[model samples]
Target: MPKTLLDVDGLTVRFEVKRGSGWGKKSYLYAVDDISFEVKQGETLSIVGESGSGKTTAALAVARLVPAHSGTVMLDDGNVLEKQGEDLRQTRQKVQFIFQDPYSSLNPRKRADSIVREPLDNLSEKSEDEKTTIVAELFEAVGLRPEQMKLFPHQFSGGQRQRIGIARALATQPELIICDEPVSALDVAVQAQILNLLRKLQREYNLTYLFISHDLGVVQHMSDAIAVMYMGKIVEHADRISLFTSPRHPYTQALLSAVPTVDRTQRAKQKRILIPGDPPDPINLPKGCRFANRCPIAEAQCSQTEPELKDVGQGHKVACHLV
Candidate 1:
């Protein structure tokens, strides 16, 4: 079996918000509430959910971009949340991020080569000659010409800017890459190109990814394992095949139903599962399951007590009272 590259346990992230005017009271907006998952070496584990479901925050915490309230993020057997100063800087060399927006992420002032070489400049001890050589290689690896390295961020198209982002992420030869909707901002045709490039790069570099996205179709293309998050909790987790073929959680089913199918027979068979009502206010969450109010088959028990994510059969785990 492949070694676990990233192990997250009971990860929780919250934001303090005022309850009323004039700072009447403070409450915690539980963005990520006791979520856990693992990403093996060379495998892609995707977290899928709707907007405000805390998927992005979870990824941010794992990357150490945002502060985690409670949890242990173990990357290559070291506790990331405990690292400080120089230790934290060193840890960053092993983990990199591909941001969602290519246009906003890249610096307009810097040339393409400079942008790609930034990570090596900050985290690597490579000499100038070595760095230049590595940057050239990265540009080529991401399908950009060596001459194009002189161009600014504005000179490139959306797809090319993302390629630059990919090259930058690869500069450190990171053990884990946290991709937050890397293709969502691009055109539909460009999204496919970028996704294919990412897969190709992963195979070549033996990269592990913690992917976050609301698009189930994109998750289906890239994920080896899938975790369905609803309102700051993981409701279902399983391998790609199991999750897609036999989703146990009502929330997971609703998500999968929205993905457009190309096959006529499959489209005819698939029915759209509509989830009613908006998610509960994060600062005033219910005592039980966070999704209880919206779950179609939620029982009294679902609202009375939160269900633990347990293995129903095989390796599939679900946190649903009905399941």
Candidate 2:
């Protein structure tokens, strides 16, 4: 097996919210609560959950874009959060981000090439000619024409803009790319194209990816491993085949049941597990299992005691009372 490229242990990110009046006490919002996972070299580990599940927050914390309240994010030989000054700058080059919306991510005034070259200019010590050559190569790698590089982001279609964003992410030549809902903003057709392009780039560059998305279908297509999160905590994690075939967690089973299969026969008979109740507020989370309120298999013990993630079979890990 390839060496682990990124190791995140007991990662937690909390936001403080005000409660009442003048001397209000701070309430903690656990955007990412004690989540731990690893991304191996050249592997894609996807984090899938509902909107408030903290997948994106976990990604940002790993990238050091957000302040982590606890835990460690180690990339290769160094702890990313511990670094300062030049070391931090260098660490950032090793990990890049691809935002969700191509339209909002790119600058409207800058040409496509300039936008792609921005990372190179900031992180690289290369000369002007070298930067230009590298940017052109990235554009080609992302399937964008050299001539189109001169065009502004506004001139391109939604799909084309996304291609430019991909080009920009590649410009840094990062070892790990955090794709936070990268294809969620694009049309269904365009989503496939972007996913394919990401796969191709990963093969060519031996890149590791932390792909964050709520869409299970996309996660199935792009991920080597899947980590299911609920209410700021990881509920299940396993290899792609095991996750899809024999999901151990009730939450994972519910998510898979909701995915639309192409087989009409199977689709017609499949029973969808409808989870009741809205997600609890992060600022005022329950003391026990965060997912207990909505989990169908949750018992009384689930409401009083939190379940620690335990390896059940092979490398499959689950944090639930039933598991």
Candidate 3:
């Protein structure tokens, strides 16, 4: 097995929410509540949930792009959350982010070559000529023509813009990449191309990915391990096959049941597990089980106390009172 590349424990990220224009008490929104997970070297671990479920928040906090309220992010070399000064700068070179929106993420004023060269500029002391050579190589690496390097962001198609973003993320030769729904903004055909490209890049570079997405099909295709999030918490985490075939968490089961299938027999065999009620407000989460209100099997005890993530063996973990 590969060694651990990232180990996060009890990570909590909070934001102050103001309800009124003035003189109102400030309430905290727990964007990412105390959650823990790890990524193995060269493996892809995906965080999947509905919108506002904190997958993106967790990833951002891990990348140190956002300040985390609490917890430790342990990398193989050091704690990512605690680094400062030059140390932090050096640590950031080993981790990169691929943003969700290709349109907004790239600076329209900058050419594709310049955009990809930005990360290398920040991380290294390479001269302009060397940087240009490296950028040309990266452009070709991401399947973009080197001739298109001088083109601005607006000159490229949506998929090509995303390729530029990918090239930028790869410029620093990062070991770990935090991809926050990187392909969601592209066309369906383009999404497939990007996915295949990511897979190919991972194998070629031995990269570890912390991929976040709402699409289960995409998660299934890309992830080796999966974490199911609800109300800013990880309710279930398991190896890919186990989570897909035998998910234990109520939320996870409900999520898988909703995935559309074409086979009539398979569809008949799979019982739909619809969740009841909308998710709780993040600003004022429930005191006990966050999913208690919507869980079909939740009992009186479920709402009275929070459940710890318990190992159910076979590399599966679940957080549920019933389980």
Give the candidate number with the greatest TM-score: 1
- Per-residue lDDT of 1-323 in model 2, one digit per residue for the tens? 89999999999999987788849666788899999999999999999999989999999999888999999998987889799989898888899999999989999999899999998898889899999999889889999888998999999989899889888888878999999999999999998899999999999999999999999889999999999999889999999999988899988898889888898986887689878889887888887888789888888999899999999989999998787
Candidates' TM-scores? Answer: 0.98, 0.98, 0.97
lDDT of 2: 0.91
lDDT of each: 0.93, 0.91, 0.93
Question: Which digits, one per residue and each the tens of the lDDT, describe model 1 over residues 206-284?
Answer: 9999999988889988999999999899999999999999999998988888778898988898899988889998888
Least accurate 10 contiguous residues by lDDT in model 3: 17-26
List residue ranges in candidate 3 displaced over 4 A: 20-25
Instruction: For model 1, state the Cα shift of residue 221 in Å.
Output: 1.2
For candidate 3, the per-residue lDDT at 233 reads 91
RMSD of 2: 1.1
What local lDDT score does residue 132 receive in model 2, on the 0 to 100 scale? 91
Q: What is the lDDT of residue 278 in candidate 2?
A: 92
